[model samples]
Target: MSRQFRLPLHSPPSFAREHFAASPTNAQAIAAIDAWPRWGDGRLALIGAAGAGKTHLARDWALKANAVVVEAANPLAAPLDLAALRGRAVLVDDADRRAQGGHLDDETLFHLINMAGVDGGTLLLTGRLAPVAWDCAVPDLRSRLNALTAAIIDEPDDIVLEAVLRRAFAARAMTPAHDVYPYLLRRIPRSSLEAIAAVDLLDEAASAQGRAITRLLAGEVLAFEGDEGED
Candidate 1:
């Protein structure tokens, strides 16, 4: 006989301001995003590893600039009316991912770039690497992309990692003991992405068990690391 399974309902939780921990590792990127209107050039590129807050910063800038955010890879089902974007900003996230397969052809991105140039509007592109590293067929698009200012978020320091873990836990309304952090620092992968994943898994397990996060829960998650270690 087959047993029926019931999946838990998933509702997104709202994060409090206290849940966003800032650190020196991402301070420059955050500052640049905060000073959007005053930036010298209209075009900006944010480069960073996964889970380095690139998407968060991009969204923040888009909201402040009152702009539209588009994915760089796939073509929009309906093209955005150029008139609508005039004087407003545009943000493209995961742009490098599009570059791998020559997905961002000149026809798609060039018009947007030209429009921003003529309208004095801001255009922000985010990716894992600089524009030069991206493969493009159009000479003009390549040159134009390279001309934009590139900013990168380096790996977080130990202090930042600790703060990140604490904040992530707090965001889920789970309070992890102070001691659990030190244990995580020693055993978990150094990559912020991994750290965030571990925190998420621990939170999920704790929520299901109706208990606070602890080293024991953390260990169970860490034990599955097998060959895929942290970056």
Candidate 2:
């Protein structure tokens, strides 16, 4: 007779405002977002690497301000109504992509920024890099974007990584020992998304083998991720 294994149900991770952990890595960025309406020039640039919670912070602020969120590439697809954005808070995510040569039209962005200024509306931008590093050709638009205050969210620290790992495990009803954090941290990439993916892979491996999560199991699981000799 074949043995049966009960598979765990998948649950989506929460991105609620209250659920966000405020650690040293992202405290400054969170503070900037919380200090909206009073921000000088009514513009802010929330910059961070992938999985550094820039989107989460932006979402939290948008929820509070009822902001209209749009991708940086939105203007390229069709005409963006600047009149509709008057007196409204606007969030433009992946702003760095606009600097990718041909992905975005600089004129559209320029007009939008100018209209926002005229309407006394707030603009929040999220990108991997600050405005200073953008490859924009329009001098006026470049100057305008650079004038906005920038809040940079740093890479994940040990505390954040541990919290991310714990949450990922908990979502799948897996109770990992405390040692699992430090053990996995030493081996996996220093990214929240990567840490979550590592947990997903490890949890699957453990369930398939009918074994408890341990340092040994983690090592075996990580080996499959090709994270060898890398941190």
Candidate with top TM-score is: 2
Output the worst ten-in-a-row residue range by lDDT, candidate 1: 1-10
Candidate 1 stretches greater than 4 Å from native: 1-20, 74-77, 99-104, 207-212, 224-231
Candidates' lDDT values, in order? 0.69, 0.77
Tens digits of per-residue lDDT for model 2, 103-152: 34687677666656445698888889888887688899888887768999
Question: lDDT, candidate 2, residue 30?
Answer: 87
What global local distance difference test value does model 2 have? 0.77
Tens digit of per-residue lDDT, candidate 1, span 59-102: 76776677788777665435556678777788888877764334
TM-score of each: 0.78, 0.85
Error of 1 at 13 (Å): 7.8
